[model samples]
Target: MTYFVTLEGETYEEARESFSWDVPDGFNAAVDLVRKHDDGDRVALHQAFPDGRRERYSFDDLDRRSSAVANALESLGLAFGDRVAVVVPQKPANVLTHLACWKLGAVSLPLSVLFGTDALRYRLTDSEARIAVVDVSQWETIREVAPDCPDLEAVLVVDGEPEIEGGTVGDASVSRFETAIDWRDDDHEVAETDVDTPAIVMYTSGSTGKPKGVLHTHGVWLGHCPAFSMYFERDLEGTYWTPADWAWIGALGDLVFPAWHYGQPVVGFPMGSFDPETAFELLAEFDVTGSFLPPTAIRMLMDVDDPADRYELSLRAICSGGEPLTPEILEWAEAELEGTVVNELYGQTEANLLVTNCREWFPAKAGSMGKPVPGHEVAVLDPETGERVGAGEVGEIAVRRDDDPVVFAEYWNDPEKTAAATLERGDGDGQRTGVRSESDGMPEGQAWHLTGDLAERDAEGYLWFKSRDDDLIITSGYRVGPREVEEAILEHPSVAQVGVVGVADDRRGKIIKAVVQPAAGTAGSEELREEIRELVRDRLADYEYPRAIEFREELPQTTTGKIRRSELE
Candidate 1:
């Protein structure tokens, strides 16, 4: 429960030398985040609903409720390694659902609450989720979507009205959250899983134009410890809050679970959407001290005139990522936030929090991505030969995968894609969890996981991000796969060819733009454009729909018929 990393000297190098990653052979995320911290009176979460309702949940409440959920899932025939879809937002039910899954040794597959029917169907089908725990808003849609998901046997609806009776919805059984767990015993036996066991399967946009699942092991939490403490400079004893959705690794791994692991309270507001004014109110109201705010969110906050004077705040540390923090944003935050420091953190869904800034220990270079986080090795590697590039030379950012607990187990079941991004192994340093074994699904080879992000390392070891090497789009901190959007647009019969690109924006870091070539002899019209926009919004996510759509006579493509996104950009 103590701070994961220790800081003895006033230097990043000294901090790195002083820290070590220690995880026991027998591990379970439920034990670490909830059960072990179950002191009946200590507050674990402070939740606020938009309806003016507020409540505090103790660790005791969480342990009992999560155990009851575990028992309920077992009664429904859930077994070890079964995937359960958690499609709720910041509600206590969302966290409880994850804890319940880990306790039963089931994998938690989280999907954004903003996803539409098409987005929901893909993840549920690909993960083969046996049950989906969703908010009431999705109940009507899930009723229509469940028949297409073969493994879906039940839907547990949260926050549903009494009239929304629990019964058979299509072929899947429907049950109310309270009705299912209220009578179950809170002493269900927790599965004794290991550090390497599969825990979370988070879907992310990939270069191949599909949303691939990034499977992280139970050790993933331990892998994030060093960076979490470092990012905040060990200033995490107080309450934590983040506007980031709990489904994101930046929120779940960086803030929520880590805060609980340290026996600290986390404030939860299902804000429904982000409003800078509302965010300030919640931050001041709860006395939150730590958070993981994305740079794009920070930009939105900057537009609020004088936040420090307008609201009483207690933020000691704020970690930012997704896009580089511009100098103007950093300067504004430094002067306005008083004591809080906005540190840039680097990592993707596959290997997160690997690079960070601890301004309390060492001065960070302006416009630099800080330094490699302690306990994790980061380097600029030549993409072709997999050799370390010299200083000041641009190369792909990569992290050693050999026994690195932060490296994902695999891209769900796509071993071919996994092998493509991984570099051949080098000798083991034995720092991360343990040595890689074929039993671990990967052998000793493929030691480096190529991030596909271009960057350069300075002589002082600070990394400067260059650009993304693929067609993926990061808009307002959400990673959107251009391919996913294009595929959705292609589903429309009027669209013959499509190209999706991310254009720079002042407010959102990037905005999605789709260029379309109408089907043979089909002329594009305003009605067709509106219809296409509606199709994307219905099939993908509301946040992922193209902001601008253009009708083109032809789209530039490679010889293989792949849309040339570079030309579109």
Candidate 2:
């Protein structure tokens, strides 16, 4: 049976064999994937704004705009390996800038528009980015901090007139992006880039301190399209929508690049905000076949009074990532959205979509992350010994890098941190017996990337997510998973959202604190907090119950919808 799940078709695997991963040597994604595969006539990007404005870009148009941006960068004397920081909201100009960087073989650093001036400076300095392409609205923030960044040479403003300010030292140049694109030539050649060459440097959300720049190569990203296409069972002919920002790997690889590679039309809602009603309208309007939304968005959509009445979902499959999809959200989507199966994919910026539950493989266990993708090996290992854990046992989620083609190379400019993250145990006697190791270990070539996530594997080889290693809340020698506590709190109808964190306590060493966003119009009170604590105690272990509850309007979340537990803590 073909493994394809269609509105009308065979199983997905049978249909998937037609499309395979066969990246050519010195392949630049802009030239090889987007331009060559999509060609000139196919619509590549359809961007809709909340203000009723819409723009469409064909593959040829994307190619031309990107080339223009590349030529403009070259005119500024930026070359291969030079870092270019892009600080724009989810918009067409952001997409153009990213592709343009790929054309010039420059490393693109995509920064979150929500970040303040200090956060921007940290990334710029850390990557040593030479130029920054920023939206005009954010120009003041960048301008305020640009003086402190000695390495920054140019600031190109998108959608704003350039006004040079006084005391701007060095050869710092300012130009309107529209004027800069005039230097673009239709036939500008794409520079040759090695497969292992760094294409993007994505910064992790720095909850602890400064964010680390995770470097991904052309080879890594090139493999992403094939893997995602296979997992989602996306046809090269269908439309795909991933409601995320360009700053995130989920949006960049899973939505934009992969869809482009498959010669599929991609849709972007670039109003720089997410509303369930608007999202539902777009899905109906575009007749999107495949789509992705965070679990939170799914919940919001579920809360809509009459989703079926409001939207016509031609969507064959929908997936959620960035955070685990709750069972409540899953059931809601199935019932309200024409019985569409909501598959969950588990991955991070460090590694994109490592394990994904296929739409055809529905009824997946709640909180399970599914099996590892083909060509990738996933294991649950004892955090200290690095020994593979037995079935139904929770351990650190580790990926064998030797066979995983999608694994990232290193953290840019931070070799020590990279070594720590990518290095694992080797097959050696005594201390290393039956242990998984890094490339520096196993006979000079094998390595494994340590996924900081903690998970468990059942007897059937289904992987179940537990919590991030750092996210595990320990109180009085009890190992409590925040997700379990959060899940229990979510059982309450009044609890719209919650984040559990361990707070330092004098008596218990640490205590569980649940920061909750109550359902709209629900009043917060001491009685409610006590009620929630008792409810958790009934559902979970005694230690897992949150001792205190703090009410908030909404829980802090990353752009991709993962709750910012660190921020809550």
Candidate 3:
């Protein structure tokens, strides 16, 4: 029950050395962690609705309700290893469904509520989700895509009765969340599963190509403890909240799971979309102590003048990820939210947060992506030679396979892609190597997992993110990352936001193009564009400046707030 272990040591080095983790062979997260350590009568989930309504669920309540859900699934004939798609907003039902899946040893796939019919169909078919536990509003999209997903057995609608056309969902059955758990027994036993057992399958946006299902095992849950503990400074009785949807790892892995794993209560607000005013009201109303805010959301909040004067915020530390946290945004947040440190964190769905600006341990670095998290070996490597790059040299970000447990098992059912993701030690140099496996313990040499993202390490050992590997721009035999250009252009007072991309050119092979969204009161003019270009030219090399600038009211962005550079390209 006392899973909340406080990390000791005054310096980051001492903390990293003192950190330790030991997870049992067969670990059932819901049963072993939540149920075993029940902080009786304490609020485990505090949810706020957009209509000014609120609800609370205790730790014991979630445990029992989740068991009821597990029993209900069993009654409906769903068994272990089955895929259950969860497509709902941040609600008590979302946590209930995930815990139920864990109890039944089923694989849970969380799909974003903002996803379109096509995106929904792609995931449902790709992950082969058998049962979809979705919101009533999203039922129509599921109905349309049900015919394409042959494995879809039924759709469990939450928040309302299932209004199926002719009372049927094609061959797939339809049921309500309340009805499913109404008569079901609230005492389902946690299924026996090993640490390596498949627990969840999350899909990437696949902006580059078809979405790939990233699978993580039950054991990876252990890795989040020390990683999040070091970053968020897990407080047992403190209130926590995340504005991100339950679908993304930023919300699920970084906040929800970690909070539950470390015996901390979390606030869930299903506002549907981001709203600065509502966010301020909820945080102050709930007295939230800590949170993780993405860069995109931070940008929107920056517009709110003097946030501290508007509401009293209880935030001690704030973490950001997903996109780069510009210095402007950081400075604004720290100033607006008094006494709060807006620290930036770095990681992907493939592996959870690998690097972070641990504000509790070290001061915040404005634009740097901090140092590699303890237990995970992260480095910027030369892609061709698989050699570690020197300071200030841009290279592919790779995680060294050394006693690290957070690395994913495989890209669900794609062995070709799995092998491609791994780099053999000195294989490119034609060196003979023996067969070494992850199961046989840590093997020596330069073997690593390719992250496919480009970054450079500064002299301080802090990694500075650049751009995606495929997104790299090469013009006239010179290399350029859109981030550097975008950062420079963003420095202009008239420029509000910008997305840079490489466009096809007959002469230079590829030319740098800047898509900018000007600030209010500032018009997109040739004169203003020239001024922006002049700012960039003075800051960066002449060739690195954007050759062309296109102004828009807003840049194309995904639901998660990442800019869609592919659309611009």
Candidate with better TM-score, 2 vs 3: 3
Question: lDDT of model 3 at residue 76?
Answer: 72
Q: Rank candidates, TM-score, best first.
A: 3, 2, 1
lDDT of 1 by residue, 153-227 (tens): 888998876665568765778888878786448887779897799999998743245778999988787788777
Better of 1 and 3 by lDDT: 1
Instruction: Report the candidate with higher TM-score, 1 versus 2.
Output: 2
User: Each candidate: how many clashes?
Assistant: 0, 16, 0
Best by TM-score: 3
- The whole-model lDDT of each prediction reads 0.79, 0.75, 0.78
How big is the positional error of residue 377 in model 1, measured in Å on the Cα after superposition? 1.3
Predict model 1's lDDT versus the native: 0.79
Off by over 4 Å in 2: 1-22, 162-171, 234-236, 424-445
Report how far residue 291 has shifted in candidate 2, in Å. Answer: 1.9
* Residue 389 lDDT (model 3): 78
TM-score to true structure, per model:
0.80, 0.91, 0.94
Candidate 3 matches the true fold with a TM-score of 0.94
